[model samples]
Target chain A: MPDEAPNDPKPSAEDSPAKGPGNPAREQEPAAQAASEPEARAAEVIERERRGPSGEPVRSVTFAERKRMNRRELLKLVPLIAVGAVAIPAFRQPILNQGLRFSDWTAGALFGRHRLAQTYSDREVAPFEKFPYNFYDVADPGVDLEKWTLTVSGLVQRPGDYKMDQIQAFPKVVQNTRHVCVEGWDVIGNFGGTRASDFLRWIGADPSARFLEVTCVDGYYESIDMATVLHPQTLFCYEMYGKPLDRGHGAPLRLQMPTKLGYKQAKYLDSIKVTNVLLSDMRGYWEDQGYSWYGGL
Target chain B: MAATVAVVKQKPEETTTVVYEHPLVVRIAHWLNAVALLVMIGSGLRIFLAFPSFGPRIPQQNFFVLPPRPLTIGGWLGGALQWHFTFMWIFVGSGLLYVVYQIVTGHWRQVLFLPRDVKGLWPMARHYFLFSPKPVVDAAYNPLQKLAYTSTIFFGVVSTLTGIVMYKPAQFWWLAWPMGGYHFARSWHFFAMLGFVAFIPGHLLMVAIHGWNNFYSMITGWKREPEYLE
Candidate 1:
C-alpha cells in the first residue's frame, strides 16, 4: 500500500493519520498523586489487566466487571435468537412431507394401465385360436384406408410416409400381451399388425436415433428410447382381439408395450419420428409435470 | 450474579474478555445442519431425477452423459422412497431440536426472527447495499435476518404439510382437499424444492461475503477477536 519505496519503514508523511485525544493521562496523573501517595497504592491504580498473563489470581472487581458485561451481552443475544428459533420446526416438517408424497404414488399409479397391452397366446408365443372363444361378428366401422397414411419423421434415415397397407406389407408380426399403466391398472388384449422393430428396421432407424417419439391424433405425444421401442413386446398394433382396432383404444394404430407403463403406450398413432433428442421446453400429456419417462414396469 | 474470577492476571494493562458464545452442543448442531443440507440436496436430486416430478425436466436422451444409476439400493422404487424419507426425518429432527434448544436457552431470539427486526429490514438492506459502515445495530437478529429466517420457517412448514398431503393421500386427504387435491400438493412440493435450491447457494455466498472466518464462530463456539464478544 506504500507507494513510497518498499523499504520505507513507517507510514509516509503523506499518509499520516490523526491520533486519539491526548491529556487524559495527565488528568489521571493528578488524581493519582492526590489520592494515592503510597507506592503500593499507585501500583494498584496502574491496573494490570485483571485477566492474568497465564495463570495467576486477579482482583474480583475487574473480573466481575468483565464477567458481568459478557453475561449481559450473551443474555441479550440469547433472547433475540430464542425469539426466532420458536418457529423454525413448524416450517421444516411441511417441506419434507410434501416432497416424498407425490413421488411415492407416481410409479405405481402410472404402471396400472398396462393391462390393456396386446397379448397373443397367438404369434410365436402360442395359438390364439386354441383359446376357443366364440367369435362375435361385428361390422367394421370402416376406417377409410386410402385417406389413412402414417407419417414418421425425426432423427431417422428415411422417415416413414406410408399407408395402412404399406405398414401391413412390412413382414407383419403381432403379439398378444398385457398393457400396464403406471396408474396401478392393467389390461390384457390381442394385437395384430406391424411390430415397432420391423417398422424401425424398415425405416433403417438411424444409428444416432436413440429415442422413438410418437405423436398421436390428439395433440398428445410421447418419446421413448429406441431400446424400449425395440423391446420385444412393443407394437404398432392395427387390430385388437378379433376386431378392427377400436378408436377408443388408440385405434387405427396404437402402441402396445407390456413392459412399459400405460402413459408410454401411445394411442391413436399418427406421426412417428426417430431421434436421439428430447423436447426441452416440452412435457407430453401425463408427463407435463411429474410422470417419469422410463415408465418401466 | 457471581463473577468467574479470571485465573490469569496481567500487570498494568487494559482488561478485556473473550466470552464464551456458541457452546459445543450448539456448534455441533450447526455443522450437522451444514452436512445434512448437503446430503439433502444431493439425494434430493437423486429422488427428483427419478421421474422429473413437478416440472422443468431434462430429457435423459444421452445415457452416457447422465448415466442411469437407477438408485436401486433395494430391489424396488420403495428403497429410494425409504432412504429419502429417512434423510428427511433426520434433517427435520435436527432442525426441530435445534429450535427447541435455542428457544429454551434464550438464543433463538438473537439468532433467528423478531418483531422490531422485521421493521429494520429495509434499513439493513439499504445500509449493506450502500456500503455504509454506520449500520443500524440493535441487540440481535437484524431486520433482514428476521424476515429471511421467518420466511424460511414459513416455507418449511407449508412444504412439510403439503408433503404430508401428497405422501399419505388417503390418510391426509382432508388437508389436500383444501389445496384442490393431490395434484396441487405435487405442485407445491415442486415449488418448495425450488425454494431450497435457491436458498442454499445464496446463504453460502452471504456467509462468505460477510466473512467465512466469522462464520467459523458457529463451529469454534467463540469469536477469536475478543472485542466482538464485547
Candidate 2:
C-alpha cells in the first residue's frame, strides 16, 4: 500500500527511528520521518542498482505515448450514454412538463392492452368485479365526482386543477388490458377512459415535462419518469370489467401503468401536474417512506 | 563516535519474528465481515427472486433458503428482515468502529491511500495473475489489494446508503437524490449486491493464491513467518 503513491506526504509508515527523548524532539519526529522516505527509497534503489546488472528500466511507457481506447468500445457506450443523457434531461424541463411524464407513462400503459385485456368470465357487468386487488384493504373507491378534481400543479404553466368530468370529455379512448401486479397477480379487465396523454395534450402542457407525479383522491400517490409513462403500456381508464365501473375499483378514473409496478397506478384521480425536475428522493409520500414505488415485478 | 565504533565490531543479533496485528475486538469484527457478506448474499437472492427478470433477462437460480422482501421476512415475507438488518448493523457498525479504531490507533498509516498503489493497479493485477515478474513483497497490502479494499469500503457505505433509501426513504431519501431517485436507489442497491457477489469469489481466490497460512491468521491472530517484515 505504501508503494502505491511513492510521493505521498505522509511519513514512512513504519517504526520510528530512535531520537533523544524530549518534547520538541518527538514533535519533530514526524517531520524527520517524512524527510526520510525518498532518501530511503533512493538508497534502496541505489543499493539494488549497484547489486543487479538490470533493473526494470525506470518506466517503459510514458503518459504521452498512451492512446485513447479503441473505437469499438467507445462506439458501444455512445448510444447507451446518449439515450440516458437525453432521457434524463427530459425529466428536468419545467413544471408544465411535469404531468407529461404521467401522460406518457399512462399512454404507454394504455397502448399495452390489446383491446382492454380479455373480458372477465362473468361479463354481466359486475360493478365491484375488480374488487379485492392484492391484500391492501385501503382505497375504498366510493369516490364522489363533486369532490373529485385532479389538482394539476407544481412547476407548470397553467397549474389550475381539472375535474374528472372535465378530463373525461378530452377524447375518450377505452382499451382492455390485463392488470399485472408485481406480486405475481394478473387480472383481465376492460377500462374505458380519456387518454391521459390526450388530456395532457389538450391542456397544452409544456413539452419538456420529464417526470409525472400523480396524487389520488384516496391519498394514494406515485411518480414515474416521462419516458416510462410514454412506453405504450400505460393507461388512464375510468371503466373496468364490463359495466359503467363502480366506485369499488378506482372508478371515475384510474391509471394502469403497466411497465412499472402497480403502485404507480394511483386510483381515484386527484391531480396531474407538469414538472421539469423529478421529485427529490425525499418526495413521494409512500415511496419516499420506503414502500416499493416502482411497484413492478 | 564511541557508540558507532563499539557497534561496528558487534555480532548480528538473532532475529525472531513476532506477530502483532488484531486485538480481540478487531478480530471479531473481521470474522463478522466474512460471515455477514455471505448472509447478505444469501438473503439478497431471496429478495431478487421477486423480480424474476432483470438486465439482459439473465436466468437465475435460487441457492440455499429462499425468502422475500427483507423488511417483512416471515409473517408474510419473517426472520429474513430481522436477520438482514440485524447483521447489517453488525457488519456496518463493526466496520465503522474498526475504521475509527484504525484511525485513532494509527493503523491508517499502515494502509494510507497511496499514489504508488493507484499507479500499481495494472502491475499488481498483472502480478496477481502471474503475467508480470514476481510481485514486490508488500509490507501490508499490495496496491491492487489496497484499491480493492478501498472500493469495498466505498461500496459498503453505498450499500448502506442505498439500503437506508430503500428501507426508510422518508428519512433517508436525501441519499437517493445524488444517485437518481427511488428506482435509481433500488438499482444501486441491486448492483451493490452484485458487486459483493462478484468480489467475494475473487477475494477467496486471492486468499487461496496467497495461501491459507495468511487466511487462518485472521482467525488465529498470528501469521506464519512474514518474510522481510523486520
Candidate 3:
C-alpha cells in the first residue's frame, strides 16, 4: 500500500481550476459579460477549452458529429455479446463444460512430477474416527476380499487378474497426508500402500500413456493424467491407521493420492487401465455429472 | 482532472460542451468486469453452500444462515463449480487489464487513494451521509470515491491470490504458508467477496443519484455537459 503513494501534489493543484457554473463569474460569462470576468479566470477558461482530459487538443464538433462519435464507441462493445450467450439454456452447459475442461488442462500442466504434498507427523494426523466416510453410492459394495484380484488391462505388458499378495509384494509405503474434498472439507490421515509408480513398473505399463482410468466396485470411476498417476506420492492404498482398510473406506484397495481431490481418490478400485484415450461419454463418476475431472488440490 | 469541454454546436444561438470522461479500454473493461464479478459472487455462494463452514468437517459447525437458493447461481454443487471455474478467468482477465492499463497510462492517479487524500475523507463522507456542504474536489474522483474504488483492487488481489492457493494447494503449497495455510486462505477468499458485496450497493446508489449523463459516461466514454463543466 505504501508503494502506491503518489509522487507529487503538482498535477492535482494544476487541475483544480474553479471554472464551473458553480462559480458565479463563469455563469455570467455567456450572458455577454466577458468584460466583467477576471483577467486570470478568463485566461484559464481559454486554456482549459483548448486541451482534452489527457492534454490532447480538444475538437469542436456539430451535434450530429458528436452523436456519430458516441455510436461508434458503443459499437466497439458488441464483442461482449459472446458472454451473453451463457444466458441461453442450450449454450450454458456446453460453455461451462469447456471452461472446466480448460481448467483441468491448466491443472494438469501445473502438476509437478517430483513436488510432494505436505506430510504430517503422527500427532498431526486426524483420528481414524474423525475421517468422514464419503461415497457416491453405498459405502459397502460387498467386494469379497478373499477372492478379490485387481484386473489390469490396456497398454500394459502384463494384462491379467493379479492377486492381492502380488500387489502387496512391492515395498510398502506409510505416510500421513491430507485428503481434500471438492466440497471444501479436508482431513489428514495415516495411509499405508505401495507406490503406484512401483506397481505400474511391475506391471510393465506404458510409461507414455496419457491417462490411468480406474473403475470401482461401488460403480465410482475416475481418470487421472499420467503425470499425477506416476507422482511419487500417488499410492495403491490398502491400509489405514496401521490396519487394513475397512468396508466403509474402500476395503482391500483404493487409490490414495494426496495431490487429488477425494472423488479422484477412487475407493474399492476393481480395475485399472493404462490408456492413451478416455471414453468420450464417461470421463469420471462425478466428472460426467459436471464436477471438475482434474480435481487436483 | 481538467474538463475536456468540446463544444458541440447545436444552433447559431446555443452550444453544449461534452467531456471524454472514460477511455475506450476503461469503458469496455468496466462493463465486462461488472458481469464477471456478479457471476463470481453468485456461483461462489452456491459453492460455499456445500460445506457452509470454516471449521473441521468432523465437528461440522455451520457458519451462518444458508444463502437462500434464489440468491445463488447454478442449481447444484457440480453446476456451481462449473460456473465458478468458468467466470473466474473472465474476472481475473478483465481485472488485470484494467490495472495494467491504469498503470501504463498513468491514469491510476485519478482513482488510487493516497495518504494525502486521507484528510478529505471525513468531509466527503459527511457530505454524502450527513448532508453537509459538498467539499470541493480537484481530481476526477473525490477522496471517498477514491477509497471505495481503491479498495476493490485490494479485494481483487486478495480474492485472486487466495483462490489460486485453494485451486492448486499442493502445487502452490508455499503460497499457502503466508496465509496461515489453506484453511485461512479459504476464509480470506470469503472475506474478499464480502468486501465486493458491500461495495456494489453503494456504487449503484451513487450512480443512480448522479443520473443518466453520469451513468452514460461509462458506456459511451463521454458525458454531455458534465456537472463540473455546467
**lDDT (tens digit, per residue) of candidate 1 on A7-41:** 12233322322121233573355346535554323
Per-residue alpha-carbon lDDT of model 2 for A43-67, expressed as tens digits?
1111111110111111111111111
CAPRI-style class, candidate 1: incorrect
Error of 2 at A250 (Å): 7.9
Error of 2 at A208 (Å): 48
Kindly list the per-residue Cα lDDT of model 3 for residues A160-245, writing each as its tens digit.
99999999999999999999988999999999998999999999999999999999998888999888999999999999999999
Tell me the spans in candidate 3 whose CA falls farther than 4 Å from its real position.
A1-59, B1-14
Per-residue CA lDDT of model 3 for B51-117, tens digit only, reads 9999789899998788888999988999999999999999999999999999998889889999999
Candidate scoring better on TM-score of 1 and 2: 2
Scored by Cα lDDT, where does model 2 land?
Answer: 0.51
Which regions of candidate 2 are displaced past 4 Å? A1-297, B1-16, B53-79
lDDT of each: 0.53, 0.51, 0.82
Ranked by DockQ, the better of candidates 2 and 3 is 3
Candidate 2 vs candidate 3: the TM-score winner is 3
Q: How well does candidate 1 score on lDDT at residue B124?
A: 82
Poorly placed runs, candidate 1 (over 4 Å): A1-297, B1-16, B53-82, B178-180, B226-230
